[model samples]
Target: MSKIIQSFEAKELKKRPFIIKIADRLTSFFGSISFLILNLLFFVSWIIFNKFDQFPFPMLTMIVSLEAIFLTIIMLVSQQRQAHIATIREELDMQVNKYSEREITKVLNLLKIIAEKQDIKLDDKELDEMLNELELGYIERKLEEQLSEKQKLIIDLSPLNKS
Candidate 1:
């Protein structure tokens, strides 16, 4: 992979606080199918070995609830860290894309100059049209507008809206 892509991943994984690293590992383990299997086995053993009523397992429920609370905290911490990393990656991508666009524009201008010097009579209508410079702000605004419109449409069509 390119250095830019490698940097995107490397920055997030490296220089992270110790607490965050632990939380990420815990989150990964807790979210896996292995965790589910373990929980199932624990529940089965508890039921088989214990004399408690099966209909309402108070002790098991309490244990599960406590586990869920801790798991949620760890997951949230990891998710927050991941969100931060994603934002950094997005900024990197935008910067790379903007640089690439500028380079492409330069190439196109050079090609146009070459064509002019060659006295090539190109009838392409697109060639006659001027190229629009990549505007990150404009694109972001347009995306936000479109997203808001879609959100509004979804809200209007939602069954919950009828009430």
Candidate 2:
């Protein structure tokens, strides 16, 4: 039930930027006079002769077709906007969480401190050699284990009932 409501709300929100504004402008442009005139014409036509059907299915189909075309354009624009926003967010996050060089330096520093605590004092040259060896070993092991478990991103939106 909640999912259904959310879907409806999302559709409505997307259409609001397109249809709702048009509706508002249309109402203000025509005023109540045009509305009453349209109804009066409809009422006279109805009294003159009966329509083909009671439910006006043909008119409903025409409306649905027109709306579908507009809705497609609106959905496309919304999707592109969403994708652009996502890319910007990803870039911002990358800048805020950059850690490649920092992480490498941290690992080296931690090893240096551990060596010092063990009373194994080393000169600058020796410390640098140790750091180099550790870095090489870490890189080798990490390269061997760098198999990403993440799946490729998919961008598919199709109805399940299609055959």
Candidate 3:
């Protein structure tokens, strides 16, 4: 318990957005060269085994079916992981910046007020698109700032560090 508390206080975990985590995991799983090797091995083994004089076709079919099932599971896991990331991003999009519900709501209200002040004549669809684009941009900028700060801290810790 104390170690866990210390870890949290240390804040050593990378402060990446959930979407990034999903992308990394997906890339690691499906984009890996090992996956390609495994696939190639599976294909070659199936073909070679099938060319035998007493080819056990039914057994081979069963093996292939099992492989398909496992492949599907892997694919589903990757998909769900990505979907989880998207869900987190969507939620974060709704609530990031200012760190308080009231402040966030105030910001949204202020944006509406500014649009009104400017007499920004946008249709509902256009307005929604603009608002979403603005929010995404804000979040992206925040992420960049955080990354820069993290990089600086890491550099400061190194012997040859120069900022």
Error of 1 at 14 (Å): 2.2
Tens digits of lDDT, candidate 3, 28-125: 77668987898789767776865653455676677779977866766676566557656755565556432454565567667888888999754576
Give TM per candidate.
0.86, 0.37, 0.36
Best by TM-score: 1
lDDT tens readout by residue for model 1, 107-142 = 877887888899986677675443456677888999
The residue-level lDDT of candidate 2 at 105 comes to 62
Per-candidate Cα RMSD to the true structure, in Å, reads 2.2, 13.7, 18.8
Q: Which lDDT values do the candidates have, in the order given?
A: 0.84, 0.58, 0.64
lDDT of 3 at 58: 74
Q: lDDT score of model 2? A: 0.58
Candidate 1 global CA lDDT score: 0.84
Provide the lowest-lDDT 10-residue window in model 3. Answer: 4-13
Q: Which stretch of 10 consecutive residues in model 2 shows the poorest summed lDDT?
A: 148-157
